[model samples]
Target: MANDNKDFFERVYQVAELIPQGRVTSYGAIATYLGSSRSARMVGWALNKCSSWHRFIPAHRVVNRKGLLTGKHHFPGGETMKELLENEGVQVEDNQIVNFNEVFWDPSNELL
Candidate 1:
């Protein structure tokens, strides 16, 4: 009766919650933590539709595998997702993550 699978979206948010203010994670990283690499796109879909949960999820902190800000359209200003990230200390250049290896947050290891 719990509709366990229905919580995939919630699980996605839980993972997002683990991303620190000045760091970021990939959609694939979050999907893998949820036990399915194939779910990365689904994770993106959930974030795109998460209009009410934006404040809680920090959906702005998630980017593509290559660290590209591919979800910019979903942001409230429609183009400042990168600016928001920059404000959080994430260095974005040419629409790609700079020093990705350093700023990446692996929730599996970093978060309890």
Candidate 2:
């Protein structure tokens, strides 16, 4: 189980790195792309632990299915997630992405 968790977490970081600066994907989408459709929460858990990584993972680009910044609290400073996305040109209001579909990037489709 330990090795499985580490492997899955590494995959999550790899996918998170692929998300475009101004786009976002859901935790579920990453899970499904990794062929672990039932592990959306696990994906989130992996991203939450990404601070230990040697390189930037851009975990801020991953959001909830509804485009809600549900993991905003994990980004260290308050509003850091929102700030990162906004800096990428993704608008946010009330902690929710405004034009979600336009900015949504699905790994299953966007990636091979």
Candidate 3:
């Protein structure tokens, strides 16, 4: 985690925590929600280290802009990320959400 940007990381966690069960969001959507449209990769960076946090963060709900489980490798087990999503009633195929637009939860639009 970037010590100087702990606040940013915390903000990312905050939004991640709000993602509804069975729904997903993109790192770029979260970054854009935080008024940092260019910080999608930073959002991913923050989520990659969320395991160290004391509280639970639904990092699995955040995927790449294309609805791909690009962060799956960051999860503990081989299929942990996909399993988590599937458990939430979100279908995945070939590491991509089956119904991305239907399950996508855009913070900018939903949190308003």
* TM-score per model over all chains: 0.87, 0.97, 0.97
- Residue 86 accuracy (lDDT) in model 3: 98
TM-score of 3: 0.97
Clashes of 3: 0
Root-mean-square deviation of candidate 2: 1.0
How far residue 14's Cα lies from its native spot in candidate 2, in Å, is 0.8
lDDT of 2: 0.94
Residue 73 Cα positional deviation in candidate 1, in Å, after optimal superposition: 1.3
lDDT of 2 at 43: 96
List the lowest-lDDT window of 10 residues for candidate 3.
1-10
* Candidate 3 per-residue lDDT over residues 1-112, each given as its tens digit: 3565899999999999999999999999999999999999999999998999989999999999999999999998899999999999999999999999999999999999
Clashes of each: 0, 0, 0
Give the candidate order by descending lDDT: 3, 2, 1
The lDDT values for all models are 0.84, 0.94, 0.96
* lDDT for position 76 in model 2: 81
lDDT of 3 at 78: 91
